[model samples]
Target: MMDAHKLDCEAAESDCRFIVQSEDEGEAIKLARTHMHEVHGREVGDDELREEYLQVV
Candidate 1:
């Protein structure tokens, strides 16, 4: 089976319940980073994103 990862924007206290899932942790981080920047106007760094958003599933 492929690796699974998840990220929930709500965890950051945003009104967005947007949850992103990916077969790779890197992909999940990229998606979450882009979403935060485009939708929430927050540009989060990779380390912070990994620590805060990226969740193994």
Candidate 2:
């Protein structure tokens, strides 16, 4: 099994209330990217999301 991960939109300095938690890193990144685009109006890459936003929880 994969470790659980968390991604917070606030970590990127936005006021978005979206937070993603999943055992699948790919799902977390995918959701985060969609949220960022739908809510924050930004396009973030996977590497950036993984390095800056994704956290093990």
Candidate 3:
């Protein structure tokens, strides 16, 4: 997990900022909105976020 976090930390600032959060739900929800609109074409809800955050972390 530390290694993964390190890898993320090494990323270019723009890329890191694009994917990171401060445990901030409001920002995450906005990201989900963008993903749903431009990528998945499905609604993104809290349940999906909980599961994804678990896996990524």
Residues 1-57, candidate 1: write the lDDT tens digits. 876889988999568899999998888889998998999888899899888778888
Q: Any idea how many clashes model 3 has? A: 0
Show pairs that collide, candidate 1.
none
Which candidate number has the best TM-score? 2
Q: What local distance difference test score does each model get?
A: 0.87, 0.89, 0.43
Which residue segments of model 3 deviate by more than 4 Å? 1-23, 54-57
Q: Total clashes, candidate 1?
A: 0
Candidate 3 lDDT over residue span 20-54, tens digit each: 34355555556655655564455656565544441
Would you list the clashing residue pairs of candidate 2? none
TM-scores of the candidates in the order shown: 0.87, 0.88, 0.37
Ranking by TM-score: 2, 1, 3
Cα lDDT over the full model 3: 0.43
Clashes of each: 0, 0, 0
